[model samples]
Target: MCPEPSTSGVSPPVDAVTGIEAETDHENDAFSDYASDVSDTTSTTSSVRAYVYENGRRYHSYRPGQYLLPNDETEQDRLDMTHHVFSLTLNGDLCKTELDNPQSILDIGTGTGIWAMDIGDAYPSAEVIGTDLSPIQSEWVPPNVQFEVDDATLDWTFPENKFDFIHARTLAGAIQDWPDLVGKCYTHCKAGGQVEISEGRANFFCDDDTLDKSSKTWQWLAEFRKLSEPLGFDIAPRLPDILKAAGFEDVQLTQKHVPLGTWPKDPKLREIGRIFRVQFLEMAIEAYSLALFTRFGNWTSEEVQVLLAMVRTELKSNKIHLYTYTYLNDLKRKAESNDSNDHHSPEKRQNTLTSEAGNDDPGDEITNNLSQDSQFLAASTSGEETLPNLKNPLVSTPSKFLTDFQGRRRFLGPSSTWAYSRHVMGLIRKYLGQHQPLEIPLNTDGTAFALEFPSTKQPGTTITMQDLPSRDYAIYLINTVKFHVCQTYHLFEEQSFMQGFSKLYSEGPQPLNAENKLWYVQYFIVMAFGKALLMRGSSEVNPYGSEYISRAMELLPDVNGLYQDPITSVEICCGLSLYLQSVDHRNTAYVYVSEYLQFYRVLHELICCSLVSPFA
Candidate 1:
């Protein structure tokens, strides 16, 4: 929390709706009128526009909404709060010496102009300008931080080569032309300026599954996306390219995934995500309610009121799993560095039994276990009635099965990580001790592993079957992998050289092969499983799990040939006008950044595995 500043004689706090308080205004006639007109075909679009225009106009005058975010004081206050939080979480205070001095700053879509105001306050000598279209910003602000009402789509008004820092947050569905905005940013930014953008992927879902799909909560979201998409804004996928196109060098994009309620695997993040989500719900109700009602039409006052009530109730419920990815994209021109580019040698690569951090080597322990399992499997394979030469099917089955059985066994006295591990080991031991060879295909298939036969096939036909690992062993392996990864991750979370290694790996150069790719991906998956286990015990530790789990996210570029990291290429291809550098990173100071850094490294390795592969 930031120290409360003297509002200095600013009139008793304006009764503006920001966070939870914003809901009360649903009683306003404007919202009612907007809702009633939705079913009216000809008037719907116009009504919404009128409502938006009017709201924008009214907001310029009477600030009557509540700010629900706990950090809802002022934009500047939030900025200071965000920075301090980020510094402590990421250990940025320790790395503060590495950052350049502050000067010119830019706040994109500076709602309330708080972030810029606080930044200006924090760095009294720096010149800060907050840009947004709404005239709802505070009338009186710090002398150094100024607000400008301008559409970011227009060419930036700032001089070329001017700003030293730029920041933007929560402008989902607002900016239509990201390439143009980024280009303008590029044109106006000074040599080493940094720009950041943060956003949430808006989503709506009901906890009870009892809420009607036709209910107001669902309808508003459907219409909100409907109106927003046609206007040229994509809610979920276009962030990274926008930053790259803007000409910010050395762009770094990181994602903060916020879950709606306690259902999230991580408790701390669940709480934080829930808080933001509730705040977002109220803000969305106020900010977009009129637009929704005006666009969709025919919402009776009773229906509208009920929908509002439903949304709030759903937000407080654990069953609702809505979440938004808050992206923190940080970009800056390359600062002069004395460090030489790092290249790995085969000898060094072969010596990786010990981690890069020079820690206690777990390679012997892991390999020993794998070898023991393999030898036992090999012996069993020779005596199998029909199971083929494939690897241990018993050891592999349970883990994959549990992932797919989310609803089936969740209520059973389900064993998690270690229980699953014990099961696997138990089965392995059982198989090794079996006296007689199991039949090829038995009536009950009581054997641990089984094979399927080809019915009426031609000569030389082959049979195949899948193996099931013990649930206990599967759980243990996964959790143990995650634990080691956390240990491995500690080395990179704050260390500059480790970060450098990760950045380099993200750029390219690593082995590429189907087997190796799958191996690394398996390790990554285990890391995530491990995190879920940790989350069951200590909630705060769950964020660390999110960081690891995120590494397993599918990379479109790596999989579909449709994407590439921004830093690798300077220009857009396929005549695409807009470009994005990476995810934005401004308000992300409140998020778990260290875990994300670790996630990026594993993701990079997985990508490299594919990129350098002979098959590709």
Candidate 2:
């Protein structure tokens, strides 16, 4: 059920700097230099056979065992941020109408495949195809989502008039000719279907009034834009006109004026913009690092690295002036296209929108054929009130309580449970949020702490914490201690903790609740200690440093035992040994080891006592 594209005449191409023969020639020279520079380096795109590259060397490059081949976490964060932006865009009325009924979708230049994956998740029934020049996406994808490593510049491989929706986003350096790409989109998009373009101007200069044009940021922006314009790809200043010219009608454009940092007048907006700045800088360092170096002929890696480091520092600082503009244009045919024969009458479409509006959830409008439950959830999370499904996704499920505790103890909580160390650690974090020094007024094993039930519970009837008895209490204590120790080890070292536990916790009906709590607590403690150690250097190590190493060793055996099912205990042991060795480098190493041994011995005794029958 694809929409028919309206047979509207294509709008004129936007040439903001048109007929300026000198400017066009200048652009040509800049592009030539940029291409030459890209080829001279011993990089992935060593041969400048193509006049342009969009994703740079990162497009096809791979490192073994890497599921996400992005340059760094910053780019990864940007990818994550796309979901946030898309959610905002998709919630709008303009997007909702088309998306609700879209049978086919095309995502052009889908990087890291995040956008496409999210769109697939949102519209499960649609045939969604994400096209990129590289095989960067994971092999495992949604049933309706598929990726093809083909250039978008080539005549699309799909049949004409196939897709109900065509989405081109962030093409920047990749899209050499915008008109041809838009024409291809127009050709492939079903009659009356929509084509949306989301693009950001690359200039780094500030749009805010706070920063002066004389700043280094101004130069950076000028140079970046100047360098890119000559490549026949600087679409930043020409986005609006480009879409209209591609035969789109009733075109709607939304410009997002995002600030670089906490410079905005509003506090919340400043925070959001600041986050964008941080993430953008992170991407710059990771993604654009080598690309920028190669693009600028005279620029060296060392120069780029130094400048990037400075830029990162500037980005983090509240003082630096910078900002960038981003835009999203949504255009649809004037009327239902010829392809959609069973078109709803305008009256029916209005009635549908009105009917959907009555449901108190936005999902009804955006998710045309989604199940009632899913629609409710999506609408609720999307923060729009238009319609409601029979079942609300936000409603809480009945808590899974554990009967294994003393004094009617329950395990499940909003974020964690009592049975897992990670959850308990999360509880500790909750405690730490309000309290300084993080010292709870409880007996070391936590058995002696007073249990406070919520008001809904029956008035206290002299319930004893000792109801678990010595054997059960001891076993619980050993498990708790082990959980804490392993989590602690993970904080100091991150690689194998989750991977190790994934094997440990995956197979059996183990104490999942308790294990999860321990993992989180371990992470918190290690992070806190690491920060303290880093702040004080070796001088601070002598005082509380030994505690870290000791905790690592104490947690190792339980972690090893946890791994006994699949992976070798030796692997965990080796990792433990390495951690211990590294921790001991500090003067507090001996003290830490001895204390950790004591903790381990205490846990051992608790477990041994639990195993022995008190009746015997």
Candidate 3:
């Protein structure tokens, strides 16, 4: 929703120069008792008007309806609700920074100026400027904070190297050229200044595998992407890279999974999710997109309204277990000074092209590695070559798996057995199509004999599964290989994997699950392994590593009735590809190449079958 124009023709509180009403002493007192003695220096000669009305909403006359959200009281209320949700998410803190005293702070796209006002109150000594396309800020504000109506995408008028801190949040669809904005920020910020960009991931996720391609929320996102693409806006998962390319250093990305409804077991997350569902999701999905879809995307208002209703209904479903990923990228402007070149210059453009080209192509590298691994496995299985060494060159020899410590052994050993046990239990429950929870009795050896079914027909009737060593070994091998990847690659800790495994295990089985239990488990393993390789700077020579990793990063659909899930196949293929990269780069390949290939081919066929028709 965009800001609305004032219904009244005349300005509310007339200032002689800027036509903006000068805030009164009473309004100032509402914000702070000890107001600053500084007088307002707003230029009376300025020609900017207060508001322009279009499509029944008020827009800033400065930019003249460029922003799509309404700045009316209703939208302001919605913004405040969103603010509450974020405040709860951050534990009532405005930000997670250690900067004790920032002399100058700037909040870009500060809707309603609530955040800016709070920051001003927190740091009374600092000068805080809130810039937005709408002049919807309240007349009563902290003396240290001032609101300005401006377009952030334009070249900033602020003096260079002035601001000590710059913050932008929830401006995902508002800005077009992010790199340009970041560059402008770099130029204007003081050396060592911090810039924080907070935005929610473009897509939603379901931990218990309820959401999928056919889900309403997923379809809504697809529609949103369709609308956003033409506006030069995208929810790219590469903010850190953009920040780095803009010459910001020490860039760090922090992520939090905010549930859509009150379904999480964790109390805090449940509360947050509840607020998000009530305060944001229910209204925001409709409010934020109505104008864009109608005006820009050629969508009929009725069509949009109907779709929004469906989306809202889906958002309210606790059974869905939906969540959105929110990410914060914190960066520091490089301290060293250098000659500033025009970003539009040919020389700068050429330099950018060269730099981009120098970066490894993840897709090409992964494909090459996969091909090589296939050949190597074929040769080894045919007994045409000796086993290849499979040790990471980056780390010291005698891998963590080779160590004989009890703690390590337990974590890398029986813990995998426990994971296997949990995976098998989930599969059994899934196979039986059980929606209600079931207790699986395990033997002392961490093996499950029969599955128990609590009868709904008879109060105490139960069904059980007998001993199945073959099934147990199959699950065990899959889990063992995953654990080996974690240990060998140093990608993820055994404890963390187990924690996730246990959490999923506790969820048991549900109907129409979006993630296959086994596939999802292996997905994380492959993701962690791929991530480890990327962290080791493997993308430069083996870009395919990044490609597989990227695919793994995305949410995977459930296997449903298939023998194997898509992600499991992807993981096995990725594992072999990684092994191939290791061999090509470090001349080390594990002896289990043939076994990995066989498993990968089988999984690949399963994926193909699932894709064709999982129920088949």
Candidate 4:
């Protein structure tokens, strides 16, 4: 229960939303106000003050394992550094909202109270409140800013429909229930209040040949995800859907790329990269690992340190253009909106986990620099699309590949396809002759023209089927993608593809032979897509097939003569592009699209020179 507000002699701070003069006393009871708002069950007691120390690091005493990161001096410094990095990424803005004067704001998981204090300073008239499990905020803060010891997972008790804006950053691992947290924010917010959530995932990526699929850095991050997912930590991909389920209207998601080192030629991005490297090497790696690896992974502190040391070395190298993906999901609550289903409906919540923060931008942001500024983009699922069921019988799937729900418009529904896919199919149809039907082959029988597989430049170092799904599972996945997902207007012909997959799966546990290298990547992507689309309710098709996608990507350049079968390259690119897009990997899909065009030009030249056959 909230302690009754005592009437004071001094003029009360005006309630910003209702324009009512609320009775209040701040001097004697500062923490309790923000504290009571977030946690109803927990009190302002000494138990929260209890601190735990392990592995030469510190963690919160209350709900000790709810959060993965430590709450210590080094961790404090990292928190502040993270705020600076986010500020830089957002071009010095405290947030993306345009509210000129927000009355009351809540910052969840406000480590060290840096963002709260900064936001308080930004809007001096507005009262700002920050909450965290640990009371580590600075003693001296702006008059309007207050630090509270509260847990977000608890029932919010301050008041319903109260705050003007709520902000939470990097809470991927802190809150166990993302939907529950957002639902609370939506409820406690005033009629038009807004919420912003910023989370970054360690999904490492590279455009060039520098970062390998087998790199330890990739392996280490993958390991962390594998372990942390059981605890419900991964965030970026599913946040948008979760927010919408909470009835947050006009939800928007933006993606920003942070390089591991100074690799970007753009001056602004280079600066971001330098600081980004410090963010990882200085404290992030250690702060991330000490608790996670030691406790859950059952590994000694020394082993974790040695692995981190090697990771640090790799991060420092300029050759590798390593980078990570960060996302911001911003939304607003409507005044008259009725609570849709139970904000925590189990079925709706289950559908959200597979949803990705899908970007509708065709690679323009990834390939170019708009003055090198990080831009906010509306997600593909941000708006609703409704179109009458198509009555035309002659309209083939290939003809509609380039369009969304409505062609050349922002009206993107389920039928929304990438521009690259449209162009690739158009070219394939043009060459094969408008009247001739397309035949997409799947077998590695080596019985057709442009079919003889080329030997690898270095066969010993070639990528083979080492880590993949079992034979039966692989067959099921291929069948799932049989009629579509071939390499040009690309798709897998059922019979031939089944024949190839049968032979490939016969190898049992042994690594695939050298002659099967091209077939290996093609088969790998087929299975990757198959499993990606076939998951009954898997949280992420991404993790299930990430290794498959990564290996096929590695084999793209240098290893296999992908140009031998131009349509094959198109098939890989188109299939992977769709699969990547499905997993909310829009930027990487864009790169594959660029690769699709690069090979399309090669195939165009081959046609002119009479060196290759189109339907071969």
**Residue-by-residue lDDT tens digits, candidate 4, 1-616:** 0111122211111110111111223323422222111174354477886789888888898877888888876677567657756866776567756553577999999988878876765455578989888877765455578878888998877688889999999987787777778767877888788888988764455545555545666556656766677666656666766676566777776666666665566555655666666667767889887788888898899999888987776666555566665676777888676656454354455555345324433222122121234342332222112112432122223111122232211211122234433444666788777855456432222222121113453445443445655443354355446423332345544554555665655544334454445566677777667644433112212234555766666555441566565555566677777766655465656777786787687667757534542344
Report the candidate with higher TM-score, 2 versus 4: 4
Best model per lDDT:
4
Clashes of each: 53, 34, 27, 5
lDDT of 4 at 61: 89
- Candidate 3 scores a C-alpha RMSD against the true structure in Å of 25.8
| Alpha-carbon runs more than 4 Å astray in model 2 | 1-77, 82-98, 205-215, 334-616
- Give the clashing pairs for model 4: 404-416, 486-490, 486-491, 487-570, 487-571
Q: Which wins on lDDT, candidate 1 or candidate 4? A: 4
Provide the overall lDDT of each model, using Cα atoms, as 2-decimal numbers. Answer: 0.38, 0.43, 0.52, 0.60
TM-score of model 2 (CA atoms): 0.48
TM-score for each prediction?
0.39, 0.48, 0.49, 0.51
User: Candidate 3, overall lDDT?
Assistant: 0.52
Segments in model 4 whose C-alpha atoms lie over 4 Å from true places? 1-38, 41-46, 213-215, 340-616
**Candidate 1: regions farther than 4 A off:** 1-99, 204-220, 296-305, 333-616
- lDDT ranking, high to low: 4, 3, 2, 1
Q: Please write out the lDDT profile of model 2 over residues 229-343, one tens digit for every residue.
A: 5654447555555544444566665554454554455443443454455446545444644554445546665666666665554455545444445556677754455433222
Give the best candidate by TM-score. Answer: 4
